[model samples]
Target: MQDKKLSELAATIADPARHDPGDAPISISAGLADWMLAQKLSLAFTSYQTGQLIVAGVGPDLRLSFNQQQYARATGLCYDRGRLIVASMFQIWRLENMLRPGHYANNAFDMALVPRTAHTVGYLDTHELSVDTAGQIIFVNSRYSCLATIDDVHSFRPVWQPKFISALAPEDRCHLNGLAMDGGRPRFVTLAGISDEKDGWRAIRQRGGAVIDVASDEVVVSGLTMPHSPRVHDGALWLLDSGRGQIVRVDPANGKQDDVAFCPGFLRGLAFHGNWAIVTVSLAREDKFRELAIQEGLEERGLAAKCGVLIIDTRTGNVDHSILLGGKFTEMFDVALLPGVRNPMTIGPATVDMIGAVTIGNPAP
Candidate 1:
C-alpha cells in the first residue's frame, strides 16, 4: 500500500483527527542531516508541552526525515535494544522496532517502531526511565518523590527514595526528578531541594538542588541550582544544572563539579553518543523560573532560552550542533539516541490500521 493510503487507513481505524500534525515550525542546523548520517544515529525526544514524540534521522538522499506522533504529556524516553519505551501522562508505553537488520520498508525506510504494550500506572509523574540490569523498567516517580517501577498489583513499586522524604505521598515534597543507573541498578538521583514538606522544593529552587548517592544515602553534591538529569558516563557523574543552564561533570569520589558546557535555555534531557553529549533545552517557563537563578544566568550571558537539542563535544565543552524548534512546542523532558537507524517512523496506537499492518514471529527451520 502507498504510505498515504496506509496512513489514511490507520487513521480510519483509530482517531483520525488526533494524529494531525500541528503547525509548529522546526529548523535543523546547517549540515545536521549530514552529521546524523556520519554519526550513524537518529534522535528521539519527547515534548510534554505539545504531547508529542518526535524522531529525526537522515534519509537515503542525505536529507532530514522527521516524524511526529501524539502521545498525551509525553515525557521520558528510553531506547533499549530494539525497543522504545515512553512515559506519558498516566501510562508507560513500549514500542518495538519491527525492521530486521539491513531490511527496509518500501525500499526506502529503515526504522519502523510499533507500539506493542502499555501499562497504566496512574499519574505518578514519571520521568527519566531506563531498563535495569535485570531487565526491569525503572523510572523517577516525581509525584511521590521516589524511584519506582511498574507493579502488577499496585500502581507502582518503590525501589528507592531520598532520605529526607519520610514517606511516599503525591505531594512532590522535594521534587525528586532525575535518576542515574550504574551496573543496572539505581545509583544516584537529583532533586530540587531537601525539604520534606509538600511543594517545599519551590522555596529553594534557586540554589538548593542536590545529587544524592542512593546506596550511601548521602548528598554527594549540593548547593546546585535546580539540577536535573543525573547521568553516569565516561567514568564521571554528569548532571544538568538547569537553573544555571550548564552541564556539570562531578567527581564521584571527591564531590567536585566541573563545568562541561553552558547551554542556552533550561536544560533537562541528557544522553551521550560517542564523544558528544546530547542535551535538550526549553524556553524557560516564566512562572517556573522567572525569578530563579536560571533567569539571571540568561541575563548574564546575554542569551535567551531556546526549545531544542544541543549536541555538545564533551571533551571541549562546546556546542557542535543544534536542532531548534519554534512555534507551538516549548518544553522538552527527555531525549534518547537511536543508533544505526535512519528514516525512522512509528505506528502509534492511535493508528489502528498501521498497528495491524506489521508483525513478527520465529520461522521454522
Candidate 2:
C-alpha cells in the first residue's frame, strides 16, 4: 500500500466502456439493468483503499443508481435482517434501515442504512464478517489470526483460531481473510498461508493459501494462490483463487477445487444474488501480487485487469455485468446483497437528523 499518484494508479485500472462515473468511470455491461430489475435486489460494497461504502441498484428508469457514503477504510459489509454491519478503520458500525415496507426516501429509494451503533475495537485489520442466526457478529481478526466478537468490557473476544496457530498473537501470521457461514454458523475460513510466525504469510502468499473447517480445524483444500472469500451458496462452498483470477467450488470430502468462473482481475469479495455470483476485482499490486496467474490469464484474453465489481452467471461462467472503477479507488474489500431493496442509501455520522431517525420497539397492548 505505497503512496502513488492518481495518474500512476490509473495505469492499473482498465478503461472498460467508461460511463461518466463520479470521480471515475463505470462500465455497465449489457442486460445488467434488466437483470437487476427482475431480481428486485441491490448491492452494497466497500473499498478500504478509497474509504467508501457504495450502494448500487437499478432505478425506475431502468438505469443504475450509485450512492457512495464516506467511511474511514471501510472493508467488510454484512446485510441481514434489514441491517448492515460495516467494518471500518477503527470500529465496527451497525446500521439499520429506517424505511418501512411502503416507504420510500426522496421518492425513489426504499432503503436507507443509518448508523445506529459503533463498537470501538481499535484496528486489528479486520476483514470479512457475518451475523449468525442469533444475531451475533463474528469477524475475521486477520492481524490477530483469529475469529472474534465484540466485547462489552474489552477490545474484542477471541472465539476461534486456526489450530496451526500456536498463540493468539497480533502477528498476522496467516492473513486469515474470510469467514463463511453455513446454517447460520461459521463453517469455513480462508487464509493466505499456514505460517505460525509474524507476517509469515507474505513469504508464501503466492501458493500457500488454504481453506479450513471451522469445527474440525481440518484443511479442506490447500496449495492455492491468495485464496479468499469462502461463501456458502446453493448448498456449495465457493471461493476466490485470487492469484489465478478464478472462482472455484470446493469439495470438502475429497479436498478438490472446481473452477466455477474465471474473472478478469484479482478477485476478493464474493456474494451471491440468486444464481449470480457477485465478486470484486482489482489490479494486481506489484509488491504483493507480482507474477500472479491472473495477469497472464487476462492478457491471454486481450483483457486488462480492473478495479470494480463483476456479476457472473455461475451456471455458465459468463459475466453478466461489470462495474469498473477508474479514479481514486483501486481495490475493493467486500460486498453484500440487499434482497427486496432498491436504490439503497446511507446516512453518515455527521449527517443532520441521522441520529434522530430511529425505530422504536413495539409497545405492549
Candidate 3:
C-alpha cells in the first residue's frame, strides 16, 4: 500500500464517536462477571471499526466493569510482562501496567495501564502481535507479506517471509493475518491464500485459506475460508475459520481439522484462558464479506452476525458466556487475556486524566 493511500484510510476512520462511551452501549451476559472471576482473568480487546481498546473485568463489588481508550484503528493486541501492546493504524503502542500486585486505585482498580511507548511503523498494516521469549515484539506485516519487528531506524525490520514470496513489498499478496507461538517462538501462521501477486488473496477468499508451519516452511492445512488467529493451547493447534464462523482445531502433524464450536458472527481475535477460548465476533460489513460463504452459513442456520466476545468451552464446544456490543461499536479485531487483574483502567492520550497521572521511581535506591 502506498503511503498516500494509507494516510487517506487512516483519515477516513478518525471518528470522534469512538471516544464517547455513550455511543457504544454493551450488554454482557448475566453470568459473565462470575465466569471471569472464577477464571481469575480480565479481558482486553481492540475494536478497529470503532477505533477503541476495551478492557473488562469484575470489580470488588462483584459487578462487571469496563474501560475504553481510543486508538485509531486499533487492531492487534498482546499482553505480556505486565504490559499491553496494541497495534493501531500507523503505530504500535506499549502500555505498562502501573499498579503493583495488591495495589488498588480508588479501592477498586487493580490494574492501571498507562501509555509508556509508541513506535510509529508507518502503517505496514500490522496484525496479530506477540512478544517472543527474547522480549521482541513480533507481528504480522500483512502489507509486506512477512513477519516483522520494530526497527530503531526504519519503519520495520523483516524477520521472516514466506518462502514463496520472492521479495518484501507492499503487495499484500496472501493476506497473512495470524501468528501462533510454540515455546515462545513463532510456530505457525494463517493466511487467506498462498498467492504472491498484489491483492491476489481476494480471488480465493472462500476456500483458499491455509495454515503454514513456520519452522518447516510448509503449508500444513489448506482449504480454509479466511482463517485467522492460529493459537496453540494444551497440545492442540486451534484457529478461527472466519468465513465459516467456526473454531477449528488442527493436528499439526497430519493437518486434520476438528470443528470445536460454531459462532454466529465473523470470528477474528482469539485467546485462551484455562479451558475456555475467548473469541471476538464482528458483524460482517457488506462491502467486505457480503457474498462470502460465511454469510450463507449464517443465513442457513438462521443466525445474525453479532459484535461481541464469546466465551466458548473447549471441552464441550459450548458458548458459556458473552459480552455483546451495540450501537456504534459493531466490529472488533483482537482479544487478550489479562491475568491476575481484577479491575483494570487505562489512560488515553486524548483524555485530560492522562496528563495529571504521574508516577515516580524510587530515588537513588
Which number leads on TM-score? Answer: 3
- Across 1-365, the per-residue lDDT of candidate 3 in tens digits comes to 77798666756556566344465678888888887887788999988877889999888789999989888889999999889999998899999877766788878899999998899998788999899999999999999999999999899999888898988988999999999989999999999999999999999877899999999898888999999999999888999999988999987667788999889888999999888899999987865656677777777889888899999998898988999999877788999999878789999967898898788766895
Which 10 consecutive positions of candidate 3 have the poorest summed lDDT?
A: 12-21
Better of 1 and 2 by TM-score: 1
Candidates in order, TM-scores: namely: 0.91, 0.90, 0.96
Q: Residue 263 CA error for candidate 3 (Å)? A: 0.7
Candidate 2's C-alpha runs over 4 A off are 1-22, 286-288, 353-365
**Tens digits of per-residue lDDT for model 1, 1-365:** 24674454445336634533377777778988888888889999988867789898887788888788878778899899888999987789999878878888767779888888898897777888999988899999998999999988788999998878899998888988888888988989999999999899989877899999999999999999889999999899999999888899998878888988888888899999988999999986657667767777777889888898899998998888898888877888899999878778887677675647666678878
Task: State the displacement of the C-alpha of residue 336, model 2, in Å, after optimal TM-score superposition.
Answer: 0.8
Question: CA lDDT of 89 in candidate 1?
Answer: 76
Clash-forming residue pairs, model 1: none
Global lDDT of each candidate: 0.85, 0.84, 0.89
Model 2's TM-score against the true structure:
0.90
Q: Report the backbone clash tally of model 3.
A: 0
Candidate 1, which segments miss by more than 4 Å at Cα? Answer: 1-21, 352-355, 363-365
In model 2, the worst 10-residue window by lDDT is 12-21
